[model samples]
Structures are given as C-alpha cells and as structure tokens.
Target: MHTKDDWITTPVTADLLRGALDVERTEHGVLPHRLPARARAQCSDGQLAMAEAQPSGVRLVFRTRATVVELDALPTKRVYVGAPPRPDGVYDLLVDGRPAGRGSVPGGNTLTIDMTTGSFETRPGPPGTLRFDGLPVGTKDVEIWLPHNETTELVALRTDAPVEPAPDPGRRVWLHHGSSISHGSDAESPTTTWPALAASLGGVELINLGLGGSALLDPFTARALRDTPADLISLKIGINLVNADLMRMRAFTPAVHGFLDTIREGHPATPLLVVSPILCPIHEDTPGPSAPDFSGLGEGRLRFRAMGDPAERASGKLTLNAIREELARIVAQRAADDPNIHYADGRDLYGAADFAELPLPDQLHPDAAAHRRIGERFAELAFGAGGVFADSAPPA
Candidate 1:
C-alpha cells in the first residue's frame, strides 16, 4: 500500500480543464465556468449560476504514468426539500479516452431546494477527496470528468507520478448549447451525456454549454457562443423556452434570429445545426411554465407538470410543437441565405417510439437508458453519411 508521502500534489489550474470556457480562482481552489464571467454577470438567476458551475462537460486532462490518482474538491450537492436524498454525483475516469472506472466523493455542502416555491438555501461543509487506483502502469492520458450535477471547486490533484497536459490530437472541436437533457441530467455519468457520447462516436473534441434550466436565448449567452472557438456548432432549442415560459411567439422568433446572428458573427460558415427539443408529452401541445408535481413527494420523489393551457398556445404562447415548426421554418429560411445552417427534429433523437421503449422517468428529462438511445441515434444522424457533421470526423 502506498503512503501519503508517495503522492505528488499538483495545484489545480485552468490549463488542465477541458470543456470550460473560463475558470475562477476560488478560496479553496479553482471553479470552472461554462459561460464566461461576462455572460455570468448578465444573469442573476441562481439556477443558471448553479448549472454552469456544475462542470457537466468539464474534465481534467493530463498525461501521467501513475497507477493511482486522487482529486480533492469542494462539491455543493443539491437536496430537494422533501425527497429522498439524491445519489451522490458520479465522477467518471477515462484512460486514453476509454472508461476506466467511476467514483464519488461524500460529505459536502448541501443546497436544499423547495421546488414548489422556487426557494433554496445552501449550507456549507468541508471538501472531500476522490480517488481512482489501479490505472494502467505506463504513460497514458487520463481524464477525470467532474460530476455533471454537482457544483465543484477543484482543490487539488495528486498522482504517484508527475503529470503534464495532454497533447491535443488535432480533432475537430464541436461546441454545443442546450438545456438540461444535454447537460447530463439523469445520465449515468458525465461522458454518457448525449453530446459527450455523440462526441466520442464522432471523434471530435466537445465543448458543451448545456446549462440546465437556462438555455433561454439570452443575448449574453449568444455572444459567448459567438466568441467561443469551435469548428462545428449545434444548438438544442425549444424545451427550455417552453418550460420557462419566458417569451411569446413575437419575441421567440426575433430572439432565435438574434442568437443565430450572434453566433454567425464569429463562425459565418461553420456547419451550424439547430435541433428542436425531443418529444416531451406534457409540453408537446400544451404551453408551459412547468410546475413541480409534488404528488410523488410523499414517496420521497418529485416530478414535473406542464402548467400552461393548450388553448393559450393559440394566443402565441410557445409549445414544443410550435417551437419545432418555427425552428424548422427559421432554419430553412436561414439556410437559403447561409447554406451552412441546418435543422434536425429532436423527435428524431427521442421520439414517441423510443419513449415507449425507454421512457423518460421524469416527464421532463430523459433517463440514463434514454440518454444512451439518444446518444446513439444522434451519432447515427449527425455523423453518418450526408449528416450535417458527416465530414467532421477525424480520418480513421
């Protein structure tokens, strides 16, 4: 057994983080941010702040010969006011881009939320350690993907051997923006999120900006997307807009156009695919500002309900169906002038049939199995012959 003296400690820094747009030096260590500071400053919503800091697609990448690696972090876990404690967020380890193992840290701060009232409170606690042992005993690239749901402040990284930044393999970079489904909610692990799995299959580098409950087409978010460097880009729109009930049809159309215009400012000709939301039964025809269905709260569980009336959609309120139609129209019209813009029906990703085979456990987010199905379907649709990203894969 190795003693404490056998480990070499390395300070966590921005240079080692992948899939993060920016990093903040925290009191304890470093916190990764998907949206940069400027964008973060524009929004005061606690939901978006928590989602971006949770590190859904962020991971530490390094080359080391160590058989054991440990990361120290201060993770802020969420607790629903009346639900059973959530399973600890999972950390996925990959060696040479393949799954090596998974683990989780315990005893961190808890943020208790009252979904019914949109209220929350946080209680602080000490940091914890996450360790992975028995890695292959030679030089290799190792990635420690942070938990996709927990807000983590990376404190330290330690390995038995010295570490260096992993050399880039010159893969095409795919940047994606979307809502919770794309943020790995209910997914088994960080790498199993649809975008991550699709990125693995497509052999591209991933930069996911999939903020949960926060993919509304905010101008700052669009500007961040515009400035971020990427070879190919994708936006999964609709679900969040409907869920938040943030805008009416009059605003949604102009907002969509403005978002696209911002991104095109930086990436004029990049293959930009706009994806509509997957089939969500409750919101398919109904408009929403979805509400918490606490019926399951007695069982220590929680579910969501779309609260908008179907009739309201005729008043210009957004529904998944309406959003999809508008998105298709917008992309088609944009494609006429800018041939690089494309559209994909998200129902193609998690449609009615797939929903039957592997249903979304919650009315909102896809479960782990559904995430896999969506990921595989996305790989086939987006990277297969003649797909928008068909030519993006690195040469075999």
Candidate 2:
C-alpha cells in the first residue's frame, strides 16, 4: 500500500466519472453536466440550464491503494434573496461501497437569486479542498459523490497512491427524473437524497435527472432519458408543473404522453414506473403558480404558498389531484399492450399521515427527515418484494 509520503495528483478525466450524461472541459477545470450538449442546446431557459448543470447524482469513481485522498473543487452555491444562507456543499466519500467520510470545501462562488424580482447576481469566491484520510489497507474502490445542489468544477484530485478507473459493480442502473423534491431539496447531502438512498437500498446504480424548477415535461429532457442506458427508470411528475403554471390540462395531457412515448421508443421493454406528486396539501385542491412568502425572511426563514385560486380548477387548470388521476389513467390504458409500464402514486411514499408528523419545511420541498422517510418508503414499495421495480432486469 502506498504511504502518505507518496502522494500524487491525478487529472480528472471522463473515465473516472459516472452518473453525468456529459462532461465539458472548462477553462478552470472539467464541468460535469446532467444533460448532454445536444439537449442543452435545444433549450435556452435559464432554469433548465442551471438545473441540469447541478451534478445531483454525479460521482467520481476510482480504485487505489491510497490511505488518503483529497479533491479540490470550485462549487457555485446558490443564495436566495430574503432567505437564509445555505450551508457549504458536501462531498460524501465511500470506500468499497460504504460510507466512509464526508467533507466540504470552504470557499467557492455565490449566486444570489431574487425570486420576486426574477433577478440574480454572481460573485466570485475561492476554490476549496475536501480531504478524506485513514483509509484501510490494500486496493479499494472509492467514490466521491458531488453535492446534489451545487454546480462544481473538478479542479484536481490527489491521493497517496496511483488511481485507476473503478471496475463496474455489475448492478443495474436506475435513471430517475423529477423536481426539486427529487433534486436533493432539503436532503442533508448528495448521497442522502431520496433517489440516492433508494438506489442504495435497491442495489442499483442511480442516474438522477431531478432538475429543480425544470421538470416541465420538456422534450429535450425526454430525449436525454431515451438515449441514456438504463435497466430501470422512473419519473416523479406534477409539483414543478403546478408551481410553474406553465401549462393547462390541454397541454399537460399530451405532454405527458409524448414524454412517455419518447422514452418507450428507446426502452421498449424496460420497467418504467410513473410516479405522481407526493402529498402537497397547499396544492392538493388549489391551482398554482406557487409564490414565495418572505414574511419570515428578516428572521432568515423562507416559505412558499400556492398563488392560484382553487376555483381555477374548474377551468381545466392542473392541480395535484388532477395530475394523479391523469397519470394513473395513462399508465392503466397503456399497460394493456405495454405491460412493462407501471404507476406508483407518489402519495404512497409520503401521504397525509406522514405529513402530519414531518411536514415540508418550505411547504414545497421535503425536509431532511422527510427525505429519509420517502427514500425508505420508495425502496420498499418500488424495489421491494412484488413491487413494480422488484425485477430490474429487462423484460424477457
């Protein structure tokens, strides 16, 4: 085994990365992207662009005999106007497939966003280092999971031993798409996100496409999913659509169909699970265009509320209830010929009772505790015995 005295610096390369659909060599370093260049080119929406750039499920995987490792990264952390400052992004390290340590860089850039004014400002900051030491002897596979909500630039990697690309674990890959709730929301760290937790429990590799504020059933996103290689797949829909108020029932139904159809074209026999929105009481019966409530911002607290009238539902505006029904119907009707397709109501994971105990802190995203509960429940319902995803292998 290499000793601490023999530390060596290695350049970050694509071969040692996973979960990112694409990677770009930036002037400062390599920037991992959740969406491919082609897909990114198709949309100029700032939200989608920023969301995809966040490395929610992206990780650096390698094998080495090093007992110490360090990664230098430049992370751009977001700060909402009239909201409390966010904690530094965390980097979780796993040794031989188990949690070994967690660390965060001290400095990076800052993005201040004013929701009410639709304005943002970027400020520069310094790069910081994340270190993990006292690894066990002999060669071992190491994974450094990037922060789910941070846009990180890979600056450099240093270790006590020479590193090589990690051998594949031979586990099935599960690709998931959703909103901020699935995008790490209030999760403590990248690996603790519900999708990440469920992936660990299900014994499957995860490719998270949970773009915050951007899961609007965009065609480019569907195409990205269609082209990615995956043995199991799922989509958590509804929340973002309602909050964005980007469409009515007329456009939503067709958009959902188109998204599913595009995915099926590439994954004809893959087990595809359709998940509706979790129980968001504020939007259960009411329509949205959710608005920020900064009443407590002076005290460093932030919250949200549905702005649309409940009566608007009568005019074909979408609501949580409407989405759930449509998703169920679509899956049932399609299952007649495509038995591989399945539906799991999001409420099954976080229902009314669960909310009574652990409410969403922001009235939108789940809190850290709620994230854990949802992750565990998802693993049990979708990946447990007789569940829709029980058998991740493609249909025979």
Candidate 3:
C-alpha cells in the first residue's frame, strides 16, 4: 500500500534507458542522443544534430508498485513563424506491455525555424511535468516513451513506490536507420510512429537512428550502427540522397557499398535489410535538391518541389527509379557471399496505389494513418514467416 507522501525520486541513468546510442549528462538533466559523442564530433551539421536528439524510439523502462508516477522533462518545441502551431509532442505510457496512459509536457524551449531563409532562433523555456495516476496498484512494468519529434531533456522521475530498472524483455534489438519518414515526420505520437508500431508488433527492442534530413550515407552513421548491438538491422535509403541532391549514381554506388562494408566489419553475419525509399511521386522520376513550395504558407500549409533539372538524369543525377535499380543490383551482387543481406523494395511498402488512397498531406511526409499502414505492412513483410528477419529470433 502506498500513500500520497511516499514519493521516491529515481536518478535517470543509462541502465533504465533504451533505444538511445548515448546519454549526455547536462547541467540541468540527462539528454538522450541517438548518435554517440564520437560520431557527433565528426560532423558539425546543425540539422543532423537536432534530428538525432529527438529520440524517435527512445523510452525509459522500470518496474514499480506506484499508482502515480510523474516525469519532469524539458522538451524543445519547433515553431515555424508563419505555419500553424504544431501540436505538443505526446508522451506515451505503457504498463505490462499495454497502453496505459498518454499526456504531453508543456512550456519548454522554442526553436523558431524560418525555412525560407534557412535560419532559426532559440528561446529558453521552463521544464514541465507529465503525470500518470491510478495504475493497477501492484508491481508491474512501466515504459514511458518520449516524444518522437520534440527534443527532450529528462530531469527527474518520481513515483509513490520505489522503482527498479526493468530487466531486459528478452527481445532482439532492431537497429534501424532512415530519413524523416522513419523519424516519424508527421506521426501523431511517439508510440504511433511506424518504427515504434512495427517494433511493438514484431516484439523487438528498437534503436531508431532515423535522422530526418541527415540519412545521407555518412560513414559516421554506419560506424554508429557497427558499434551498436543489434540482432536485426535495416537501412532505408534513397529519398534523402535524391532530395538533398547529395550525390549522383557514380558516388552513390560506392557510398552504399562503403556503408555496408563498415557495418559488416562489426556484424558480418547479422541480418541486414536494405529498404529503398517509399514512393514520393514528385521525386520518383525527377531528380532533386528539393525546394520548399511556400506558396501555401499564407494558408498555413507547407509543400516541397523537386528543383533538379530533368536533363541532369542523362548525366547520372539520381532519381527514385535510378536508386531502386542500383540498390537492387548492389544487393544481388552481395547476396552471393552475404546470405544475411537482403533488399526490400520501397514500392512494396508504399506504392503509387497507396498514394492514391492515402496521399501524403504535404506531398512529402506520411500522415498518422499512413504510418499505421506502413507499420502493419512492414511487420508482415519483414517479421512474418519466410521474411528476411523471420528466423533471427523469436519475438520477446
């Protein structure tokens, strides 16, 4: 039996955390980072830095008999000057592997980004508390999933009863890397992200390294994957490379091989699945360095347009079609010796047909319903019988 005054404060530590590659002890609290310090030190890209700290799939898990639990966190919210106010990031609570509660922390730092100018400003704000009351009233597993889009710095955790770090759930860890789609771009909540949903359905611990605009085949990202412990791994490539106009087919081919080689150095036999980009009609045939189409901004809408010259395709500029073909060839060549390596066509996950039914609201990121569809399809394709990762290990 617990009383109102029996609040126990638990120190936030790596032992009680999951899905993050590193945890930084800030002066105010602990900040979970998807990219480790060494990797971050190698790149000074601000966009990548921001995306990695968003904690797409990170969560704190513990066991306690407390009926009430409170978490103190400072979440950095992104605001576009002319765009509509983005919804507050939602924190999801799971008890005994079941959805128990959900709430959003308010009053945090604000990052005002001006996409038109490619500039931004930050304003500091105060930390807020998230509370969950009236649990089942006995010792049980509790997982608090942080917001997928907002940058969160955890301050403290309190409960009516003392909490203990939850033991490993015996699930194989799935390390996944991709672009903003995998980073939960338009996801409604943390747990509702495609990766989160798929991990839940597949019963695996998730380490999502989906660094929005930064999944550009950087060696450091590959090295980060190499160092992480994972029984299953996936790389979602193509769209980011095309949208950023980062590389052509010539450089792209070698970069893909190098990325896989780096990971193979550590986990030669690990089940690795390479997934191409989900369909984005605008970039499917056209090359890009995508540009913002802010014509709709006045109406609180934002959109994108491919700015790459179609003529550049003759000079080897990359498009989704080109990428898919090249990736299939690369995987086929490697599969001869690397039996664990597999390729999943992105179209299989979301094709032109899917777009017709559930169109991308902003002509880019998927909406909440689309996220659910992708998650369900992924579970069936990648985790079901005869799937690439089907025999890796039984679900936890």
In model 2, which range of ten residues has the least summed lDDT? 387-396
Model 1 per-residue lDDT tens digits across residues 1-396: 668898899988777889999999988889999999999999899989999998998999999999999999999989888788888889999999889999999888999998878899999999999999999989999999999999999998999999989999799899999999999999999999999999999888999999999999999999999999998899999999999899999999999999999999999988899999999999999999988778888686667889999999889999999999999999999988998888999999999998888877778999888998899988888888777888843332
Report the number of the highest-lDDT candidate.
3
Question: Which 10 consecutive positions of candidate 3 have the poorest summed lDDT?
Answer: 387-396
What Cα-based lDDT does every candidate model obtain?
0.91, 0.92, 0.93
Residue 132 of model 2, lDDT score: 92
Overall local distance difference test of candidate 1 = 0.91
* TM-score for each candidate, following the candidate numbering: 0.97, 0.97, 0.98
TM-score pick, better of 1 and 3: 3
Better of 2 and 3 by lDDT: 3
Error of 1 at 368 (Å): 0.4
Candidate 1, number of clashes: 0
Candidate 3's residue-wise lDDT over 1-396, tens digit each?
A: 666566899999998899999999997799999999999999999999999999899999999988899999999999997888888999999999999999999999999999889899999999999999989978999999999999999999999989999988898889999999999999888899999999988888899999999999999999999999999999999999998999989999999999999999999999999999999999988999988898888787888999987788899999998999999999999999998899999888888999999999888889999999998899888988878878654432
Please report the TM-score between candidate 1 and the true structure.
Answer: 0.97
